[model samples]
Target: MAQMIVRNIEDSVKTGLKARASLHGWSMEEEVRHILREAVNQPPPARTKLGSRISGRFAGAGLLEPLPELHAQTIEPMVLGE
Candidate 1:
């Protein structure tokens, strides 16, 4: 077992980690080790092109209707500045 010294930690972050560690009945070191293990084991998010996920979910939902023009240059400012 190796030891580590994490530096430059904020006071609030230390407090938060202590609370979380106590909640799980684990020392902060054990809690952090468990977290690292779980994080390393999960698969990365699948890569997809823009709108591909939504396209299948809304297949019959009217092709998402045309997205309203979001061009800021075309919109006129309704109110004048003070």
Candidate 2:
């Protein structure tokens, strides 16, 4: 495996990276490698409608609760005047 060196990173950026690495249970170097891999390795997101994407995400999650039936007798039809 090849190695890469990064220099001149700001102190705040380094601190943030360290904190993020700790949160994810990784060393700073491992976090950097993970970030770089994610940046370069992801396949392009599918070119699909937003609805399709959303549906695909929750496809097998679970059944939603059924809505209660509304009182049809109390509803009035809309009256349009010309």
Candidate 3:
């Protein structure tokens, strides 16, 4: 078993931890240990690409047709009215 000393924690944070420990029926130390264990044991989140994320957000929007690629199209600059 390893022991660690954390310093300079804000009074509010300490109070919050104490409140959480009381709510869970655990000592503050036990609650902190449980929190640390859970934090370290979780698997890393999968990294999704921006385009894939965008597609996923609109997946249920009923957009069945694939949009045309405009990579080869040229854009003309808009002329200012006199």
Model 1 CA deviation exceeding 4 Å by range: 1-5, 51-58, 64-82
Off by over 4 Å in 3: 72-82
- Give all TM-scores, in the order shown: 0.55, 0.51, 0.68
* Candidate 1, position 80, lDDT: 71
Better of 1 and 3 by lDDT: 3
lDDT score for residue 6 of model 2: 89
Q: Which candidate is the best by lDDT?
A: 3
* Residue lDDT tens for model 1, 1-82: 7777889999998898888899999998788788888999999999987789877677787665776666656656788786
Worst ten-residue run, lDDT, model 3? 64-73
lDDT of predicted model 2: 0.89
Candidate 3 global Cα RMSD: 3.2
Question: In TM-score terms, which candidate is top?
Answer: 3
Cα-based lDDT for every prediction: 0.83, 0.89, 0.95
The number of residue pairs in model 1 that clash at the backbone is 0
Ranking by lDDT: 3, 2, 1
